[model samples]
Target: MATVRTLRISLVCLFCLMFIAGFAYRSLRMTLHSASSGFYLLHSAPHNNSSPASMELELQDLMKVIEWPEPPGPIDYNFSTSPFKTEFHMPFPRATYYVGEYVEFLITARDHHGRLKTYGGDYFQAKLHSPKLKAGVTGSVTDHRNGTYTASFLLLWPGQVEISIRLVHSSEAIAILKDKRETRPDKVYFYGFFDGTNETMECNVELAGPDICKYLDAQTGESWFCKKPKQIPCNAYKGHSAGQSQDILTQKEASFLNKSVKEKLISSKVGTFMVSPKNNTNDRGICSSGLPNPNPSGFYYQDFWQSRVCRNRAFPTPSNVTKCLSGKIIYMFGDSTTYQWWNFLLDLIPSLQRQELHMKYPAPQLAIDPENEFAVQWQAHQRPLTMKYSDKEELHYIANELDRIGGAKEGLVIVINCMAHFISLPIRFYIKRLRSIRESVLRLIKRSPLAKVSIKSGNTGYLYIHGSDWLSLQLDTVMRAMFSGLPVTILDAWQMTSCHYEPHHLHPGPVIVKNEIDLMLSFICPK
Candidate 1:
């Protein structure tokens, strides 16, 4: 009996040890696996099924993903369908219409295959420019996903309004644009700073290496990490060339709007009032101050931009502009668009001569018209700037720069735009930055009520896929909403640039620059 009891106790001890060993083995495996792997987050929404209820659910989900989703896709459909040409014909051709009547038509496209591209994703630009009436009105194009699309316009100006269409980009080209933005870092311009008085070093995007110039400004406490330039004191600096500009997909490309699109003109009178095409006398949203037309004021052409506001235009002539700007001090803070605006003003007003200021980087691109006591200066904002500017020590935060300006004098014009550079960053950064700007502006107004402040709206061109246009528009919306609550005037460049037929760009054509400047003058000396 004693021998049997001893044998059973020995077996029990062995089983207890095995259980503890199994538990510990599992714990060890879990720790080792976690250490060897990485974790990431992803966001997605699904869509597009036939049933009505399901369709609604799908759309709801998609809207949550992209407020405006692209035309329902083969989401990966080949852009090679290649739109060759587009034709616009009034469904039941109308001879004329009353003022403000909507004119609609069907635009058909045939691809390189000469097949009516049943799957729609082609980009087409349409315009209603009547040189005879001095009008250039932009119209909208809607794709039906059936190769047929809709073009609509409201006839605000009564004249021989002619229609024209051009193919901008095929859906395929846009796809390429979308891919490049995500897969490549080339489109973005980056900056970094070095420490301990690195005399031979400067921030350059051209370099490629593992070691980046990581810097933090001691005074402002701003931190930045930049890619190294080609040659560096830190042996690791190598620069990457700035991204290439998007090649404008024109007719010269494999596909374009078919050459058969004929110009259509509306020569009839609007509501029995026969108006002269030479001058668009109609007014709807025109204000005496020449603020942007609140209503759809078709297009008005007078060589210079004609706002819907009544003809009480400010600075109607070059000399008129000079007189209006006399004795004013202007400060500009922005990217290249604002830079171009400064250049335009310099050229238009000859008396404003470029001064030989010794300070190079942040000296403020200044021009002085001593004869008129007018001075305008443009300082490229700190980093993420489009050009390869030398990052100088004097570079100050925009808000700090604004705070430093002394009590503002009457006739002080401040033009500011912060779009192109900030596009690549997360939207939160932009929102926080603008909120800070709003506070600064409010303080400025508190100190000097007579000083003028203007915020330049973002232009349309950058696509959502490329962190521009659709994406930039969102930021623009935030900017407008923030400033709208403030007392400053907003120069509505978005509508002016978006509505016209020009290829959208960071630097718009000379015509756009002129219109923008003229509008500025209107606010400075509102008639």
Candidate 2:
């Protein structure tokens, strides 16, 4: 009985040992398998290595290289020095050369999975990069399904030129990308009088911009006649002597009246007429005398009457002029020159009403006629006392007023002309004020979606005070710095009126004012 019991105990121990050994072997195998497969032993299967979280790839892998065009001459168009390439993928290369030149580039890229992919395209854009060069050229290739891109560029000038190229690529993931590129070519050319032909003279006198022409006309005291047939001068007055007489009325003074009648007749042909009668004794006689004694031996006065009468044939009146600003809100800011613009606009369009906003000290409010078709509001925030007192306080007041006006929700055409006031100040201080004003204006425009900001560079024609020409120069320099990045249309009034000035002060006369207004309007309503 004792031996049988011992045997049973031994068998139980062996079974226990076998079960322990089996469990140990399975655990060892699982640990080795988990290490090799990069999976946790506690988990059933290996984690996906292709998942975004598991892969450590950069954006460069997905980007493709762009091939650039070759240089025109023996010049070394070094594009390898540019820091535009990606670590993992190649960059889209761009180059600027002449029109008939060939451009070659290599684009090399590798995917995250260690697979290579290549793509290329060619194209060019036309844009002028130099004032001397008249035209520009560029070309590119599209439809890259065939795996090749051919680009070409050509320089118009034969002289020394500088060219810049840019390469760009966009990618959101590995092996997926888009590329875009641009280039600018600058060429040197000489421009001067070619010949004395009428076309060449016309081209030479051709205005840099309409503003320069209008300003010249205005400075020369010419009228800005609107285009209306009824307002135009009669054709008969084109070659008619200013001292000529007419038989329309029977009065000794009728000859003088004919002079006026002649003016009226000429005025009827062209909608507008410039009245700058020359100073001469004949002009007085045309106004005073009626009829001149006819001479049979020398000149036949009756023979001239027939042609004059034929030329005086009248035409039907034309339609009324079209209104420029129907319901638009045109806002003018700055000093007297701005006021000149406001007045010119008001004189041209009766629909415009002159309004004022008085901001006394801390608070400011805008006042305007709601029923008026157009309102010309002027805010001349000049602190004459601030020159002797605290300029900062004055600037604060100006900024507050600008903020209030700029925040208006209406469709606004804001014209700004400011540098004249702060020209005398130190450059730093002037820049500070300009920056503040710019920021305030920008904030206002950003707040108002319908605002179109037009900035007039301070008028050089007029100085703020006597002996302030230096101030105007400083003001321009400061303005250029302040408006570097802002999307403000700069109206160069100073350069426009560089040739002329008012009698004693720098203020431009009515003609310059009109021309400046026309120039401003051209930008406001471009043709």
Candidate 3:
């Protein structure tokens, strides 16, 4: 009985030892496997069945994954049966992505065959539809370089988008490529304010070029490039090169002497000039010439004398005039003669008002007041105002400046006058420049959400006495036609100065200046 009991105890002890050994062996094996492999087993099954080839195959399958969601019904249609597939590559791949976001089911298709038809040059139509928005179409293609038919679409709102590309080949065989892409909610970019008061507002559109840098260096003005030279300067002497007189005038001695003489002459005649007084001899009209003659009361002398006299005494106190242009910028672009008109306007206004000045070449006297509500700037090149080169260059500069101002939330009021300087050239050239200026202003207005344009008609007839009547008639015709269908508001200085002529020249005396200012005031500030 004792021997049998001992044998039972030994059998039990042996079984216990085998169980411990088995557990140790299993733990060792697991440690070894973990060291050799790069996976850990937690609550799920171990992933040790994958091979490199299998991984590659999985990636390929992922690339072939259809962008669309699973169809409602199963179908046996094969992609191989499709006639053609259209694809596009974005030159800037990163542009497809925004920071801190991900897009799912982004589809990019390519045609195995490179033959596709196009219309209107190389433009192709791209249609995009979103689940929550109206369908949109690309208006035109920038280029169809080689066989690549590329188009860009912007996802402005978060939703599912369906992309459809159609290659129109002749009247038939319109190839269609369709894909649906899911875009994650992305922050929509809103540029400057679009309020009617702000000038920088623009409708949302897909941009193709480089992002415009808004913060331009203010210290460095526009980089100068040599434009086509002008044949004749606008106010150059008959024999001298067109713009050469500017260089001559720039000399210290000449400029100082000329300015001194002008100031002295103007100051001496300030109080002596008569206002727009009625003629004593006849009731023909008020004269602007101020000189009493045999026909002092006649229409010619009376009107001339009155215009000059009124212009001298018509200075308006700032308090009396409504400050309609207290914070707006008004640009006056033209030649030196235009500068004179601006100066005259400034002088007629109260000195307490703020103003700023800016000048470009040839029109060195240009000035403006940044702080003034009614600031004016003049831009003129040395070339003859009639020359296409001058107008083109001036327009380019104006466009650039307008772009800059448009970026800011400021409205622009432009007044342009150029015909007086260009009168020497063929009428056609003048018309061309005028048209170019008009087009440039129109472009500026289109770009700027808040802009008003006004044009001062040519004052050509006022400068030549003997030919005044004929010149006036011609100017009247041109002014009437030039401003006919346009938005430009005309300021007629020619008729205002019609009767007032310098003793030997056509230059309007002080009286005409007053008449011109009154006309401007009436238009600029009604009532």
Clashes (backbone N, CA, C under 3 Å), per candidate, total: 18, 39, 33
Ranking by lDDT: 1, 3, 2
For each candidate in turn, the TM-score is 0.65, 0.35, 0.36
* lDDT measured at residue 35 in model 2 versus the true structure, 0 to 100: 30
Worst 10 residues of 2 by lDDT: 177-186
Model 2 lDDT vs. the true structure? 0.33
Per-residue accuracy of model 1 over 1-527 as CA lDDT, tens digit each: 55744543443333234323433553353334321111100101111113556535644443354332233443322334443344556676555465567676677766555556666665665666666545666677788878777877766666566666655555554454444433444445443333333433334323355745543322222334455444443323222112333433344331322222211121212222232323334544333221443433335465456665444354545588778877677789887788888888777777778766554544356676756656677876655454553433324446545655557546667888887666655544565456556666777777887878888888866543244454565567667666654667777777677666466666789877878887777777775
- The per-residue C-alpha lDDT of model 2 at residue 362 equals 16
lDDT of 3 by residue, 1-527 (tens): 56754544443333334334533553454344331122212112212234557645644443343121222232222211112343443333332333113222211222224334232111133433332333222222334333343454433223344444433221111111011001110111112221122222111111123322121111112211111112421111111112211121224323222222211110011111111222233243322211222211111222322221122222255433326454445566665555666676566555323222222344323333323333445555323332222222122333333333443234346666665543323333344344345445656766773565656555533322112222233434454454556555565454343223332133455555555554444334533
Q: What are the per-residue Cα lDDT tens digits for candidate 2 across 1-527? A: 56754544443333334334533553454434333212223223322223343222311221111222222222111221111221211133333334323333222322233333233221111111222322122223232422232222232233333222222211111001011000100010111111122111111111233311111111111111111122222110100000111222224322221222111100001121112223322221210111211110011111111010011111111111113343345656666667666555556554333333233321111223223333345545433111112211122223434554534454466777666544333333344345446666667767885566767766543322121333354467456545655656565555444322222245666655654554455444443
Q: What is the TM-score (0 to 1) of candidate 3?
A: 0.36
Give candidate 1 regions above 4 Å deviation.
1-66, 71-81, 85-87, 108-124, 132-134, 141-149, 170-186, 190-223, 227-298, 309-316, 360-363, 407-409, 422-435, 459-485, 498-511
Model 2 vs. true fold: TM: 0.35
The C-alpha stretches of model 3 lying farther than 4 A from their native spots are 1-315, 318-322, 349-361, 364-374, 385-411, 460-476, 500-506
